[model samples]
Target: MQDTTQSDPNQQASTTPITGGEPRYKNILVIEDEHFIGELYMRALTKAGYNVKIIIDGPSGLKEAQTNAYDIILLDLMIPNMTGMELLKKLRDPNSTPNLKSKIIITTNLEQADEAKDEIEKQADGYIVKAEVTPKQLVRFLQSLER
Candidate 1:
């Protein structure tokens, strides 16, 4: 067999592509179970011109979601209690958050495309698999909410 692929120095990566959009969120809520990833996202989103708040557990995240108003929420489906899916359902309820209007984005390590699609259909603005996305990608995702 012979090598036949073109070598382009400026070739783009095949990683997750971030879609750009307007500045919709001034404040964002990040609900992640993993402390490291939560911190990582907090730093990235903050640097992206969006104020962000981090919650490590699901219940606390739910409480915060109910009490405070944010432009968007970065949620993780797996948590100790009050799972992200439940959080999403609560957020979608008209009575759960009468004054809430934050767009929810599911962020997890799940590789299942069906799960991501299900979340989108359930009201998540977007989905990002943590292990599969970069910091810049997360930041750009925050930017996407602005649209």
Candidate 2:
């Protein structure tokens, strides 16, 4: 059997199947300001047997992400209190916050210029436009991440 718990600070998740066909990443954190979208993700992900938590603002999301060890973080760009880019900078900066093991995936409806988009993609594990994807599609994406 593979070891699920990570000893390395840089790698993301406790990625090993426990029993049956359960996914490696069981816990997920969603940072989104839109109530409907957050709820939709929570509902779909929970139903799929993954634990999910949703934060409405970037500050709270950053704080929670810093303090806890979530397997994945679904971040929105246009959020209250702070921007996702700012949060990404802080989270990815080893000098500011070290030993962050969560996989941060950018989930947003906002469009970015070529250079900006390249930068965002560089910092994050994955990027998905919220307006283009559904809750079920997001769940599938998460599952694919485990592979």
Candidate 3:
């Protein structure tokens, strides 16, 4: 399988100001199983002036994503209880959770075929390989969504 672990150019061109005189905190939800990775993302996003919440499993994460409003969602593919793909489908369905308008970004370690990646990209706003980007870079990517 090809390693499609590169940042989107459009995302790289984002010039949104994450911090300024007053803190403009954008709410973010992170659905990751690994404690270390989730904490890393929380720290980086919090430092970048974003309100971040993390859920370790898919079921609770899906509930949180549905009940609350968030600017962005960082999702892991291979999560417990419910998979990220299942959550994505539910989140995308207007009838399932009508108020969920958060931009979903897949942040996973799983490798997939090119066709599968394309399908996932169509479903999600963005995709990132966990090993490919630093926390700081992830922040930049999230900032890009503001534009």
- Top-scoring candidate (TM-score): 2
- Cα deviation at 143, candidate 1, in Å, is 1.2
* Candidate 1 lDDT tens digits, 1-147: 665757577986434333432244678888887888888887877666678898878779878988988888888888777777788888888887788788888887866568657666668778878888898887866665543
- What residue pairs clash in candidate 3, if any at all? none
Output the lDDT of residue 137, model 1: 85
Number of backbone clashes in candidate 1? 2
How would you encode candidate 2's per-residue C-alpha lDDT over 1-147 as one tens digit per residue? 996844777877555543336767999999999999999999988988898989999889888887888999888888899998999888788876687888889988878899879989899999999889999898889988877
Order candidates by lDDT, high to low: 2, 3, 1
TM-scores for every predicted model = 0.77, 0.84, 0.83
Q: Could you give the candidate ranking by TM-score, starting with the highest?
A: 2, 3, 1
User: Model 3: runs farther than 4 Å from truth?
Assistant: 1-25
Lowest-sum lDDT 10-residue window in model 1: 13-22
Identify the leading candidate in terms of lDDT.
2
Per residue, candidate 3 scores C-alpha lDDT tens digits across 1-147 of 676656687766435365452233389999999999999999998988889999989889988988899988899998999988888888888998799878899988879789879878888999999999999999888766665
